[model samples]
Target: MGSTSKMKVLESLGPLLVACLGILGCTQAVTLEVKERNSTCIKAELSALLFITYTTFNSTSNVSTSLPDSTSVDAASSSCGAAGRPPWLVAVFGSGHALGLSFATNGSFYSVTNLTLQYNLSDTSLFPQSNGSGVVTVVSSSVGIWAPINTTYRCASPTTIRAGGAAVTFSAMRLEAYMPGNDLSPAESVCTADQTTTTAPPTTTTTAAPAPTPPGTPETGVFSVTNSSGTVCLLAKMGLQLNVSYVSQSQNKTVQELVNVNPNLTVTSGSCGGTTASLVLTQQTTTLNFTFSMNSTTSKYHLSGINLLANWSDMTAPFSASNTSLDYLRSTLGRSYMCNTEQTLLVVPAFSLNTFRLQVQPFGVTASQFAAAEECQLDQDQMLIPIIVGAALAGLVLIILIAYLIGRKRSHAGYQTI
Candidate 1:
């Protein structure tokens, strides 16, 4: 309690207090409302983290920030119009970012036609090649929301919007256009990522003993195929596993075998063409050939085909499969498709493959790097299940506590004096 000790303690606590305040100020909910002719037309509330990545001096740098962080939005800059101009709303933020949403209405229904985000890269440290600003068309000519006029749209999960090198991700968002009142109502149509699919618990069944463990840990690495100019045209990072079913000569029954495509497999041959790219992985007597194709119209690419050939000592002959007409992995240019859960693909009836922690970008990559990623449905489902379960468990606990209190009160009703 001495004066000197008190001063030292205060000094030590000052930094911690500042750090706590900084963390608290990092994120805040931003609400944008548009009014026309004294009637609120659009209302949106978003509370999410935003990240930016750009190239500077041939190297890519990333900046992470949350929306409405220390920046204010002017009410005068947010406007709505609908007369002959196909109902649109634009909100400008003090950070030199603008969000625009265009709406289209038929006689019965209204839909969002386009969503755009204009960002300014004025900070030289964050964006080295800082020009004035740039525009990223998030969704163009796509029906983002289609509901009856006055319903709200809600998406609780993270949604990624990508365009070329720039991308924006939004989470915990709620929006309403042509609102019935000034406030946002319950959402009528939910985003697919927010929907939950209830799967029945698995049933018990008698089974044989588990098979032996596969060769080694699932190998994970990046595989790329470069073009004639030595530019990487296809890049994929994944852990691969091959499953083969063959007749066991000793047992005279079909037996399942698992093989891990480890990092020891070398790239024996590969080629990148104008419309297609191929990579071949070879190890001992096993070979895997991956073929990818691009769709110019959509500016997207996919793993269109695959071929597998393997020679096992236990099998009578080499197993060969050439699945040319297939569409397994797909993503847009400058973006990758990521799936952390294991994904199974059947090349043939008896032969199948699995991919884990897979992320692939087929084209428009810079500095051998991966751009933004579109998570696979399985990954989204995995994320959603935990939230749903947690909510359910919390509700059950609340119900049990309420029931216990009611039961206790009822039991004490017969007691005269306590």
Candidate 2:
């Protein structure tokens, strides 16, 4: 089939695969446990978003898909490494796809040796060709680096490993291997991207005026989700900065990238409901979706969830966070919640958001202008700090004055009746 026709077929089958695998029932976590003679030798837990890319029938373009959350380890086929042999684990998806991981350890440290993905191309409902079952090695490494015995290994950014015509990407990954016990704890060793800095030539100094907004700084603007009748149901105004961590494929190190949400960018889509509303913004390879929910009893609305997906040139697969919960940006109906100060909203282990000059009114509103304002926690805290400090200073001043007055009385008592 032609590429266009093949894509159509795959698109049609997407919903079917979701049903066959019961995506809602699938868990995005995988765990491996190895025991020897009643003692646990290795225990690894991994929770992340996984993506796979491959080619079939000598196609020029690659086919990519995310591994379903329902995938689970095949304990029967997996084994622990011993002596000269290496340890391997196999995970099987309901769609007949299998992922395998091979590990190498030299007592002090351990590393991944290979990542293999197996699929049956003959399954017309999935792949484009009927090439029987094929196995592809997606990643291979000869060097060993993960160290220590009990600490978990964390790579909050996306890491892509490519081998031959296949590639695999793992994001927001946490793994614990060669564990002395069964429980998992905080990781001490973090994988980060390499950085190179260059010294700029010295320049003449000048008087600094009020600094203007930087060239690439995001500007705040009002965005609204409207109902079928054109009535606005949800409104927001903010300058957003998305922070994502990923391993650079070229540098082989993890790096954090901040992406600004251009307020000028058009809203791709949105939905407005009585109790819930959503707005989606897309710019280049990054897409952000913000969701809001209303509390009927309190007559207030709040930012309830966030979903972000980004595809960077330095990485092989897309970095994504789906349905991340949030508890801030709240205000009563007709009132806009405002925070002029910068605030951070941690969406997930791999993603966070920095919002500037945020103002949102997710429910009833009279005009485009803001009504009664509600202060954000950060702004309220900032205001409270000054008041607290002023009160403390006033108390200190009062105590000093009282002590001086008492000292004066004591001195006069010792002096002659002047």
Candidate 3:
């Protein structure tokens, strides 16, 4: 009897021990290899909760105010005049829970402003930038670095910022991406956004044709991407092909979809940052469908939602496949042929991956038409609310039915045959 009891105890504890080991193995930091070569771009997968600390230059108070983790205030209301309107400095961090922040900016600026971020979770401070004293003058179509702090961003002090008075010295803004739990909190990589002047292309009006390129017409093409190491990360020889289709609705003045889908993507002996491993989509497929809504008035193709299906391949510790739901906001011009280059951050449950650029060339014709505006609009709540309410009502009904049945059983027992 004693031996049997001991055997049962060990069996029950075996799975628990394995699970604990798995948790420990998975907590180590993950890095993404960022690559930008001409027009093609790719990066290692990332998944984690993201946080941000925004420091806005309060021109009215003549002091900079630090907003911890997605907090926002009005910039135009500040006494900084036009300088306080656009191009606010923002820091983004990722750790895993879901929250929402506004990335919509006024027409004059490229960056987002007037943010009142809200979240419901166990909040913790991940970034701590010391208070610094200084005033920086900014203007339209220029990049200025906020000043007066330690180079390592650890200690705070007064800062002096200056730029060219005659010609433009800086053309873009950059934000860094770093690994979690670093002692120095050093930035491993940087993402840059440039300011550019665009000329609107002339619009051509076409009368309705009897059967204008039937929508949802399936077209197939194969393209391959090779890394600097001479290893083929994506090869048509390795059974890779993209299937695309488009649908046009005339009355609604919208073009619904253009799906560029690839399946069974297998990577052999590929290096992601420092690790060389094989990558396989657990679902064995990846679909990037562009749902477009056209505005006839502006002659623009606004993106509605990007349907992405990404899962991890089978790998060992420090490398696991995480389910990902990517968010992207973009728009394009309405033209026969289009070529739009855009980048977005892919957020997963474990880490936030680096930026990657994607080019869409439809119908075997390559031309410039699509353009991307950095924005995020998610419908997570709209999809979740109905299910939550239904589940609560069903559970309440179940409890009442169970109580009624139990009461009847007790009443019958009370008048049992005596």
Candidate 4:
């Protein structure tokens, strides 16, 4: 925090750039198999074992101040040391506006050329976790700026992450290009009004909001979708992870698996006709004309569906919406939540978003409910039953005629009599 300390970090910059292998020598080029790049910006894959998600990075975005995996730390004499170069990222979790970011290289303050390019949350309070003491120099031929490596920002455009954090990508972290001597700060992902951190709700004296109606509590294979209420079809994802209150209409009362591709993309598939369910996920997205149609193995019947628009934000109104666990979430993290800005603290007043997405059949029984509904309807069609019965009767008469023609002739009359 003081220049004496900062100067030590600045002293380590420049003239010591390492191009050889890291001390641990873990800098192997990653071998990625089955990397499915689509025209879409993001893609995901889900199977019985491991789940994978991949997003294309047309550009670089901000790293929020909270969560992990955002910042790198512990620089010792070289960038190759695990303790020298920080390697962390940000997650959409935690309790407040400011994320904890700290990185120390060789226990000395430092000045480095560049910090990672980031889609910084719009927070005035956040400061670089870097030690701004090094007498470092930066050289970016494109930007045409060559100052002591005391810079914090990489000349990255902000347009890379206009939608939100759930859809950001990265090209590289070249913070050293400019500031060569500063101690690195811990990278953090700050949750703004748009991003949210989760905390357990305070116990209320008032009766807990009646547990969300589970999928198939009072009934089986029943589900509901809400958006001022229409045919309730179109939507991709607004976080549909099953929660404890989730009701199962076909199998057990809980879900087995969930796949969230993005804020607007998700997939939840399961086998449910009894107590235990095996599930799969195909696609859930904010893309228009998204369809979800699958068959239920129980009755061996057919079912299908579609939504008009892509799934939108989960915010319903006045800071409320559906979430991964079927619990209602207000847009804002909540009041009394602290936001650290340059040593200042703040709290949210209210929250909201564009749209919300819920299940058609409780938390884990959509396909089965659909199949059951069809089966129940088929059973009720007694009038059609009689018509089908009549058709069978006509077929029986035809079968009798064919048999007589094949076996009985006038010459065989005596044999028939016998």
Candidate 5:
């Protein structure tokens, strides 16, 4: 009889034990949320997605000589741009070396700065289908500069880019990069000239060289620090409107470029967990806020907040915190991926970027607390099952006790009557 009772007890608890184990298994796969600042960098490597030709040149005091060697790199050979079309992504890598000694030949060096690539596309067929515009231009700044000896880099331009035509040729095209020594900013001149002009090519070239170089124009803007890796991740915008002119000695003319903040700006949030974050930005307001969420157990994080502001020098358009709207951009329930592991820099469309840093907000979740929290959450639903069983058992005991009392009362009455 005792063995039978023990078996019965074990059978009674079997289902409950299975339920608990099921809950534990589910907890292991919970989505992790991180609410605070932690550094994780995602590697972002861009492939060239266009048809490009590279011609090496050696400059001297008397005349500029172009090597007989010219190589045309077809974007179709690489893993970038749209299929069955010209390349859309233009990735350029630079290094510091003797410009006159190495670049003049086919050699590279250490410590290069301000590696940038600008693209201009005029052909209508090359125009991106999304934005039906005849002109497409993009510039990348503050790239591949931080390295001990040399840094090889790749950056993607804004989406839906088209470039080059048969008649329009980029003459004297060079890479514009600067080295630390002598403060001589190397300038790559991608001169756009019509191929139809059947004239003698000019011997003189306008290169970004040592001193007596073009005036260094410093531009400023505000960048939001939504998230970042351990290293500095910075993003800024064009805050001022200015038309600057440059003297092109090779062309013997003045060239002008315009820098202005978009009156209306739109930024699409990144996709995480099969969804996307999005916002519309404007220059009239200030103050941007950020909110983040972290799960200690899983070490996962998410962000939500309003009115997060990034301030920079010389903001021509008035931006006040009061007028600022905070509901522009947001982070999802958990981290899309780890930070500081080399990820793509998400930028608003139609704007050129130079450099900025992003540092994630710090939120720490401990293992002890994580387990406790998970247990509590599980108890909220499962606790009802145990409570109902306990209530039923108590009711059964009460009925039995009442029946025994009734029997005793009847027996006492019978004895009194006798």
Candidate 6:
């Protein structure tokens, strides 16, 4: 009986000891490589991606159920702004948790449940700058299985990563084919999916089309970008193409480029009247140029210039940029910009949902169209009410005091004469 007991103890100890020894000996230290190229852009700022989301919250991390297959997707790289973050990173667009699986390509399953991910940047080894190399896509498979863990994310299809510290890692695990294009909600589009489905684009008038050039001078919008395939964004409605060029020359600012930075920027003509528009920026060695047009060929009119709309209620507008209380509310309560004021421009989609009046900066809009004057008139009135009341009270007191003093002096003089 003693010998049999000892044998059982040895068997259990042997596997445990081996695993411990392996762990200590393995000491796998992960290394990362950062490649910086002049291709990021010639401008001080360029749009690059940061998140490469794969899994999501409240969803399956099962490599098969979660990942999109090996296919291309017609995703909007950016929203409201051309340089927007990916979808998976935004909780409103997508987020949740699920189990994840890893597999090998050889129809073999290894360990399941060893990998985990967080949509938030966690490690430096994950997102490299705009090197155009680490374009990653999420996928799932059934064969070579690995472990999965729960995590959060913004968008599922994470692309165009910018300078980031946390890098995603898959340790010698192969992936399975996820369906290319699956019918998904806006949130699900962030995850990798088979890119086979074609969805209809939204019907909206946007300011991405090319402007009609006056026969006298052809002003083209130049975008001095680094490290990208030389392509252009055609404001199909605007019939304008923002040409991304490699400018060894100095940059120039066109009317359109000015409007992009400060949508209130304008030369003298056209304005942003719609909910959506595309703005491209370019700099020659010295000059910058931007052009305004509509989306696609559907846009026929070219913006002549921009007019500065008058700020009507300067006094009642935001005090000192914005109210700090509101900003704090947004930060702590997951709300919109708390610090925003009526005087500030509301370009984001959030403000569109609620009917609030705001004057577009005098930049990209016409003087007559964006007529919503500042609403600080009411605030100014409230401020003046107290002062007016105080002035009236002081005047009444002074009059009463003067009358009493005058009467007292007359009485004293009359008594003296008597």
Candidate number of the best TM-score: 2
230-254 in candidate 4: lDDT tens per residue? 2322211222222111223332233
Per-residue alpha-carbon lDDT of candidate 6 for residues 285-371, written as tens digits (9 for 90 to 100) = 111122222223342223221111111121111111111011111011111111112222222211111111221221223222322
Regions of model 6 farther than 4 Å from truth: 1-382, 385-413, 416-418
By summed lDDT, the worst window of 10 consecutive residues in model 5 runs over 97-106
The candidate scoring highest on lDDT is: 1
What are the per-residue Cα lDDT tens digits for candidate 2 across 349-396? Answer: 888989888887766755555677889778989899999999999999
Candidate 3 or 6, higher TM-score?
6
Task: Give residue 14's lDDT in candidate 1 (0 to 100).
Answer: 42
Model 4 alpha-carbon drift over 4 Å, by segment = 1-58, 67-399, 411-418
Query: Global lDDT of each model?
Result: 0.64, 0.61, 0.26, 0.23, 0.25, 0.23
> RMSD to native for every prediction?
29.4, 22.7, 27.1, 24.6, 29.2, 24.0
Residue 281 of model 3 has an lDDT of 18
Give the Å error, residue 362, model 1.
Answer: 1.7
Error of 2 at 212 (Å): 21
TM-score of 2: 0.46
Query: Per-residue lDDT tens digits of candidate 5, residues 263-369?
Result: 24423111111111212122322212223333445554443322222222333211112111123112223222222111222222221122212223223212211
lDDT of 3 by residue, 225-256 (tens): 33444434332111222222212323223222
lDDT string, candidate 1, 81-157, tens digits: 43334456666654466666656443334555445556667655446674334543332222234455567777766
TM-score of each: 0.45, 0.46, 0.18, 0.18, 0.20, 0.20
